[model samples]
Target: MFRHVKSNLLLFLLFFSGRIVHAQSRAVSLAEALQFAQQNQLTVHNKQYNVQVNEARLRQEKAARYPEISGAFDMRYNQQLPTVILPGEFRNLPAQNIPVVFGTKYAATAALEGNYAVFDPERKYNTGKAKLQENISRNELLVAQTDLALEVRKAYYACLLNHKKIKLTLGNLGRSETFLRNTQTLFQNGQVQPVDVDRAQFDVQSQQAELQKATLNLNQNLLSLKYQMGFPLDSAIVLTDTLLLSGERQAVFLPDELKVEARPEYRNLQLQQEQENLLLTRNRHNALPTLRLYGYYGSQAFREKFNFTNTTEKWYPVSYFGAELNWLLFQGFLRRAQVQESKIALKIRHNELLIFERDYVFQTYSKLLAMQTEQQNVHVREANVQLAEKILNVTRIRFENSLVQSQEVTDAANDLLEAQTSYLNALYDFILARLEYERIQGK
Candidate 1:
């Protein structure tokens, strides 16, 4: 009953799990898939935009350090108010002989202003912070690139494995059907029991069920790869690198220092910690006064010629050069509180940096162990598959000569199926292990 239910479930999955269209397909390469995923992934696209934004911001920050020049022209007209005499005993309106005059007044001014900060403790530190921020964004982009490549490789491998599984399942189904036909023929001749024919029929149905499941799984994996590559859902593609199961992507053992240096995520964290330290220093240095040397050279002009400077030049001259020092004497206690906050933040970042380094070390070691184990399994599983194939060949001859029972031949076939499946699984695991290890190593 359990077997029958399982078989029904597989049939349902085959009918509904994925869409099917029997059509010729084109092949996709690993490199092409990875490139397409990087270009099409929404997250990667966003990160690329963020890098541009950060670059613009850094340029603005750097520009702020240079001198700025601006010009302003102003004109104002005002009306004067008239003075009135008070009506008092000492100064009566009849005795008063005073004049009240109301007139308009105008003032026009034009000047160019320029300023440069010769020395500012904060600006100097802020420049470095902007650079570090740029580095952070760049590292974030690299991290996105690495993650997308890893995902593409995994998905590509999945589709390839699923295709193999479908083929394997279909082959098993054909063999089972053939076996059922042979058993029926033997039963008619009274050479085998009817029970053997029934069992052969059951095996054929079971293999057919598994084949359906394999077909469903293969199509689903293909769809997933298409989604990753930003291809149309109805589009058909065949993987070209089926025979290229695994390739060497790493050295036997890279130097620990090299991994630490090349890992983008690690460098990003290190930059963050440095930024935190710089911020803390800025907070502590808040007590230091900022000094600036500013100078401006401008010309003034009036609607009518003015005698302020009778120079032959058509414009009036107004130039000034000065130095100013500013110290934050008091803010309603804002500076002190900021310094305390920054110190606390720096402490938190320090702890986080420690944790990151520890985890990175652990991850590197774990990957190394996994890669070694997978390499060993590849060799062992390959040998097991060869032995199973040889055994199946010998059993087939014995069964044809009437020296072995049909059940014995069926058992050998089942063993061969298991061995082949086990070898394929081992190969797949080896690939997965290598990918995982590389991912951790940030290769």
Candidate 2:
């Protein structure tokens, strides 16, 4: 008995602490949560990083157009002097062979060399491709943001709907408890059978069970909302938004005004198509001849015994500038294969763009229809809830006047709860559908 009492006390303390935490929860609106998610969500941050990386790549490509200058130095010693054979007739010694080295035993040289592309057909296209890639990355970041906003909306709506359900459940629970007390009073006055009192008690227990279930569901939905918002789940939060529809009807867009091109995803695909076309052009231009201007200014020293510091030693300076042209007449058909591959890829991307446009048109129309249907369902459910309330009030009055059975009263209460739950579900669906429609419109 003592152990049971101690466990009950512990449960009471936990329940009381939970209630206090709930009371102190910070209130947040849907817009505030979405803004917070945009600032702190890991996915959005990663997408932003990708955009930065592509921007840097664009700078690198542009910088490549400048001339390149480099300095080089080298020192070398000949282990065995290089020898060249000369005819013996030069020395007037017939039938004799003599070997002579043409270069110094030790040598050192330093030079600064510069190169500039005089004519490069592919460079212009490469810069263009880099700029296009940066634009694509920016659009991709926008796409990620849109996706994250949709996820936040879904989770937020679910949490708000769960909160509304909990409120309605609590109201029903209160009414059930009151009904149970009235039934017990009638039994004490010998006005109703013991079975009727037992039935009333069971109805109250059922309502308690429902309240417990709704509370658990609400807690889980809150955790989901927190995860979507990138917020800490251990912290307490209260949603300030209510699950209800505004009296005004939402504006619906016609098919012609859908403007699929406004969507980031579609724009990204178009950019990709441009990239593929650019690749094909670049590959085709690869066969063109490239001309480059190169120049070097330097000095060299040649010593018989590595005596470069000797006053007698001298340094020879050299300078020259020249233009070189290189034409890759053939690369074993490698360029041919690249050109063919690029053509195929460009075609593939074009096909994807067409398919995407068609699918987006269908999807947007479908969502619009769903939003309209759900809006009508919300109105219908709202009316049913009102009717259920009236029916419940009448049933209770009938029970008090001894004109109806206890089971009828319980059934009426159940009907009202179901009607209220259905209404909340309808409202949630309508809101989600509307959000999706807006998303498809690129809002």
Candidate 3:
């Protein structure tokens, strides 16, 4: 019995301490979380591999401009058969050696060789191709970064919006409880009708249901934010941002001239154009011949004894140095076809790029208009929330002074709660719309 009692006490103490710890825990801000993800997220790992892959490709391309060196050694054994025609002057090849190498023979040689390209137009364009490939890889990584940031921002704002909903729901529930108490007091004094008390009780119950739903929504969005930020399991935090739609706020819009020149999409297209030009140059260069210098030094030795007269004791040193031009006289018109194919692809990409620019401008223009409209909505909702608050306060005072019906107080409370929620939603929508605008513009 004592042991069980002690365990119960220990459990209570632990639960109480956990509550204290939770109360003291600080919330991680958005910027700090973003920085952590940059260093720790799985997407960063993928981007790192992408950079490494392009780096390897660049190295391979640059290596094409250098000389290649290689060496090899070979050893083999063989057997030979011979024929005899005359008795004394037999047509047998070296009768003594024929018997010596009758079953198996051994020969070995080792050599080192090298080749350096003296002239190639393709190599010149290859250098440029490698650099442009690096640029494309960098842009791709940036796109990933921007995408991840956008996801984080959306999740963060969602959590903020849900948190505001929870607060509004709780406030409504409290108001219901207070109004129910006032209605009961009035009934005890015989000032209000019994239906008034019933309606007030109904309001309290409805607000309780809404409060529960709002809490669930808040928890779900918290889970989403945790997933987006890649936080560890069991992390608990409360949002610290204020939930209010600003009444008067404005953004400085960029001019059309500056917007087109500074956008990432435009720069990406420009990079692609340069890369295609380099490829065309390479295809054109392929029509020319190539020149290279090849050299090798080798020696073959088979000297059982250092006797110069013996056939088995032969050793010689050999060296070679030469330059060669390799020209494909014809490939059955394949080269011409390839060049024409490349030219057509280049033109296609150019046309696609033109279409893309037009679409980008249209999209930017549309997003700007959407953001402006959302801003106006935010202002209207903010004003409504403020006015609703005043009405709820005045109605509550009048009910307390026996100057209003319980239904009037209930209506005012509901209106206030709805107004608060609408304003919060508008606040979230405006922020998200602006973020989308900025993201698409590559700000």
Q: For each candidate in the order shown, give its overall lDDT on alpha carbons.
A: 0.73, 0.83, 0.73
Residue 270, candidate 3: C-alpha displacement in angstroms = 2.8
Q: Per-residue CA lDDT of candidate 2, range 182-208, in tens?
A: 887888888788898887777766766
**Model 2: how far is 276 from its true place, Å?**
1.6
Model 3 lDDT vs. the true structure? 0.73
- Please identify which of the two predictions, 1 or 2, would achieve the higher TM-score against the true structure: 2
Candidate 3 residue pairs in clash (backbone atoms < 3 Å): none
List runs of model 2 lying over 4 Å from the truth: 1-19, 22-25, 76-81, 94-96, 102-106, 248-256, 304-313, 331-341
Kindly report which residue pairs in candidate 2 clash with one another.
Answer: none
* Candidate that scores best on TM-score: 2
Better of 2 and 3 by TM-score: 2
Tens-digit lDDT track of model 1 for 1-443: 35445555765665454334324555578888887788888888899898888888888888988987788876655455456554444555575555555432544567778788876778868788888888888889899899878877877888877777776676666666666666677778888787777777777786776676777777788888888777677978767777343444223544244365577877887897898788878877888887777777766544333343545636557889888888988778887888788888878877877787788788877777877777677668778867876776677567656688767767877887787688778767877887877777778
Each prediction's TM-score versus the true structure:
0.77, 0.88, 0.81
Kindly give the stretch of ten consecutive residues in candidate 3 with the minimal lDDT sum.
95-104
74 Cα displacement, candidate 3 (Å): 3.6
In terms of lDDT, the poorest run of 10 residues in model 1 is 249-258
User: How far out, in Å, is residue 63 in model 3?
Assistant: 1.9
